[model samples]
Target: MSNNTVVLRLARSDDLAQLSKIEQTCFSNDRLSKRSLKHWLSAKHALFLVATSSDAIVGYGLVWCLKGTRLARLYSLAVLPAYRGQGIAQVLLSELEQLTQSKGRAYLRLEVSALNHAAISLYKSLGYQVFGAYSDYYGDGSEALRMQKRVARYDGKGIRLQVPWYKQTTEFTCGPAALLMAMYSLDTKVALKQVDELAIWREATTIFMTSGHGGCHPVGLALSAIKRGFTAQVFLTQLSALFLDGVRSEEKKQVMCTVHDEFITQAHKLGCVLYEKPLELDQLYKLLKAGGRVLMLISTYRLDGKKAPHWVCVTAIDEHCVYVHDPDLDASQQAIDCQHVPIGLMEFSKMATFGKNRLRAAIAIEKLP
Candidate 1:
């Protein structure tokens, strides 16, 4: 349950059957044909990676490495339902970046549906910036946001350590670093020298981060990162999300609180910093000055009253600027001006209700180290 236990190497031709199944299960009506999967399996510059749990494929990703340069394109990524909150897709992504970077790739690119907020948020949190949107990019005429990330050069020699996926477990049990010991004992049959390939559905009652749910659920990922000596935290807010897809109104507070508490506790136990409510602009600036990466959870309310509560990551900040994931924006650019962004704090807090009282407060910050 902890550690970068899953080994990500190259996908073999035999993996076509499983990969095809995943594509079908993940893409709904947009599933690719077996023939297409075969093409990707044999792709020369493309790398396919499968996330396995005791040999069963749980997730996958595909990346296209440019032939003559260090640029790579992330074509597709997915993780099965039961395996999602575990951060399997992220591991596959970070692995692809490592694979491409090893090949001298400097830039990473991908296109996501304009409505797919989860993908947009994850990529931005991982250091990707948006460029622009391609109208009607999908066959169904849906728009797509293009995103890209620049990989830092590798200076460490020896074998590079594989990164682990962050998981959210309700028990708030074992940390990821300790969980890694278990992962290291697993068998790795993957063949590394071969090419790589890439390939989530929302299930109900399972707690979606995008939906505002108040409860104390541990973010397994922060614990995993802490175990590895990396400062990791989960970000959440008390405000209602304006655009969540599948959560109920009464459940929002519980979902958000649980997710927030879990990440904070795990981060603290792992020796990372934890920040709770009443966070001010000065406190944020001070944290950044301490010389570490911080994940800020900002809340957005849907003034239109049709969407659910949501949150985004604050990746960068300055006196006059704040850079965030802003899943609502197109993915091909770096940051957006705070003034033009969606759902400000004041607009979000007004949605919360305590018994007969409807509060207009728009913001609350809980920091996890």
Candidate 2:
């Protein structure tokens, strides 16, 4: 087959049956149903593409633009067995990636069975990097490797500011992990390792957050940064004790209070500035633009389905959105595992609050001038 003869175009309603047939023929398990294919073919914020030869469908690729973030997911891609090795899959992927980038998405992410060496090789050849793995991701108990590719965008110049990212090793360490990223961005000499991560967690942990070992409060995290010789400024909308609503026991509340008191004393002693009002989004943008790093507390419900407070680093900001380095890693999705995930400013503002108190906290850090 000649490459020039292959036709690539957006899938239509009539192509659903052929796409479903290709799905059934391509894999033993996790095949998309005909109904699902039909729905995705017409769904908003999604792209269904087909590659045809001689007016017959040979392969298809499905991608989803994640709402509220400048990222896209390659939900599935498949080529007919007999059509394999004819460059059909490559053609489909190339067109899909270009379509996604043209929509202003910065990353293309997908998951494949870890045992599928052929697919993995093809993805790597196309510059995809494996960032995480999930056990038993499929119905057949097979592991899946999450991979991502950066959709490069240049404004006739260079790229955005690159910020270092580190994933939290434990569930309760997102604050410390995010803090470490901000600290590292401000001072590259600061080393990041398991021990340092644990140490920072110990220093900043509130003893009890919503559940597990208490997450780091904004004051605690700011103290950790200050102790590391970085100038830290904390912005909080409320002055009340942090994370007290989730704790029912008076003793636990007192412990939280004690921790908050210690952070306040340390802040006063070290001359760390603590703003009693919320950090305006514009201020955050200005800080990032002025070579400062910000660690923000956000509700994970926006990124994942979990309604929990999580911390992430503000790496860069553009005209329409802010780029974040999320410390919490999702094994099943590699885009969330990578750095510089773009979140729209309005969505970010809505996601930055926690609890009934609507607590909004952020810490901006920079090396001493």
Candidate 3:
């Protein structure tokens, strides 16, 4: 195979040593460990492609498919010093983008060293745009520039909101955190404080869930926003007590029902419009276009199989994807992964429901002029 043309192929376990060698040769620091390379070769949501001239591997590119989102991340890419002028890096990267799009991803993202002018030039030449940056992102204390290229085209009108992210202080405060992000996007004077999170949770809690802190109900959440003097609207598929099947305790169920009923009554009194229908992304895009902030409820089951309700602020929406600011940041996820997340349009529609009852909920809020 050493005398043949440089062919591109999927990486295998046997290519581990060559891949590690390329990584070491191409990068002075921040090299991928053999263990990690081995893992990606078989990872369910990852793609590792290699370029080989005959037998020896000349270059490689790896991407991680962000599950439940229309996003794939180019984790690493490199070529041997001898192969630098052969355009192997570009070939590998282009193939990575095509593969990523074939997997239904709308965007392909990557982080490169801020000082890597050659790599940056290549990325720009390939239509990748700089979106953000990170300081001291590498082991050698070098900064990194975050870039992403839209791979799949969108059909719906895309709208992205300028929203500040606030991670939930506690597990049960995702609703409050999401709400605060939306509120602050509309009004800069609004504060993202722990006290505010707890207060909103107190006002919006369903009172009980399958276990620990109960999730927030759309009615209660809308009411919370109304209390804060923002105009609010709610969309839901059902109006009954939610998460009832999760808990078997009749007392807990009743407590949740009581809270739910109270919220509904207050929402009605406060003139919150309750739409007995599903809130589609097209509708969300229009709201975003009109400068309305949205907080949406989704099941964590689709995200991590937790089967719990989670709140995320809708930052933007298009026909192909729903951009969101997730308040529930796991240890495995970086801040970039949680901010302005792009959940695929169809994937989001499925994930926007919760429990056996398949409850769908969304709340739109706007500053009163």
Candidate 4:
């Protein structure tokens, strides 16, 4: 079959079986079942396009339009083996890109297995750039490369900052990873590696936050940044010791208290500024516009439905959404990965609180100007 003979159009309900077959034939793991294909076909803001040759399905591409943001996710793209090298995949991709662009989206992002050189080459040829990587993302232990391409144009009026993003190697190190993003944004000379990540975690961790070796407190993170020669300011909604609510044992409570007190003393000695108020979205916008980076504490429940306190860097802010560089990567769900993730302002506010204390913590770090 020639490329000119293939016809590309929106997938219909009748094409679900063929789409499922193509998915199974192209991918060994993470293949969408027939039921899943049906769901995607019926989902709101979903675009599933199929390429047909001789009135038979040869390839298909699926993309999702993110709510309240001008972004689209290319969920899957696959072409049958018999139809390889005829530009069928490229045609499907071009059609999908046009479809997404017509919908007013500015970017189209996707993930491909690192081993899929052909697919990666095709995406690169079509102007996609690899922005990040996920370790052991597939069910078969294969890593995935995250790539994106801009499908629409913008004037770039809002504060859109770009920072080096790193995912935490361990679940307890989100604080360190987020802080590293902030520090790196201010000082591009700073290297981001696992050694420095763990080292910073050791210096800042409060030994327990709800569970498991604790998380970093705002004061400790501020002190760590200041010690590294960056100006740091801590913002908190409450003046009390942090991470004290989840510790049931008196020994653990006392240990947390000791760590918190030590951080407070270090902050005072190091001249780190502390503000006794929650960092509002407007305040964060102003700070980013003024060329400062912020590390914020938020609940993971909003991103991946996990009820744990996490940290992310505020990289950009505009009228529609707040962009962040999340340190933890949820491979199963591409939306939560550490990249230019856009969260609605209202959703961000709900995700910024944690525990009964409704702890809202943020730290702004910047170079001394």
Best model number under lDDT: 3
TM-score of each: 0.41, 0.73, 0.93, 0.73
Q: How much does candidate 1 score in TM-score?
A: 0.41
For candidate 1, write residues 1-369 as lDDT tens digits: 222555565788998888888888888655668997799889877888888877877788898774433357887898887777777878889888888778756567788888889888988889888866778777788888877776636322111122122222222111221222122212123211112100000111224434333211223333443443444433323323312333455576466456545545545666654333334545545544553333332223332233232223333344333333333322232222111121223332232321122311111122223
Candidate 4, after superposition: displacement of residue 290 in Å? 2.2
Q: Tell me model 4's lDDT, rounded to 2 decimals.
A: 0.84
Give the per-residue Cα lDDT of candidate 2 at 277. 91
Please tell me which model should have the higher lDDT, number 2 or number 4.
4
Across 1-369, the per-residue lDDT of candidate 2 in tens digits comes to 236777888899999778888988997898899988888988888988888889999888899887557788999999888889988888888888899988767778899998899999999999899977779988899999988887746432222555777888998898888888778877888887778888998998889765668888888888888889888899999866887887888988998999888888888998789999998877876787777888899888866667788898887776556778887766644535456777766778888988889999999888886
Residue 119, model 1: lDDT of 82
lDDT of 3 by residue, 1-369 (tens): 121367788898999998888888888888889998888899999988989986778988899888888878899898888878777888888888889989988888889999999999999999999988999998889999999888875454678778988899998889999999988888888889999999998989888888887878888888888888799999988888778998899999998889878888888889999998988877888888899998888988877868888999988887677899998888866677788888877888899987777889999999988
Candidate 2: where are CA atoms >4 Å away?
1-56, 64-68, 75-159, 335-337
The candidate, 1 or 2, that scores higher on lDDT is 2
Error of 1 at 88 (Å): 0.6
Ranking by TM-score: 3, 4, 2, 1
* Model 3 TM-score (2 dp): 0.93
Please give the CA lDDT of all the candidate structures. Answer: 0.48, 0.82, 0.86, 0.84
RMSD values for the candidates in order, in angstroms, are 20.1, 6.1, 2.3, 5.5
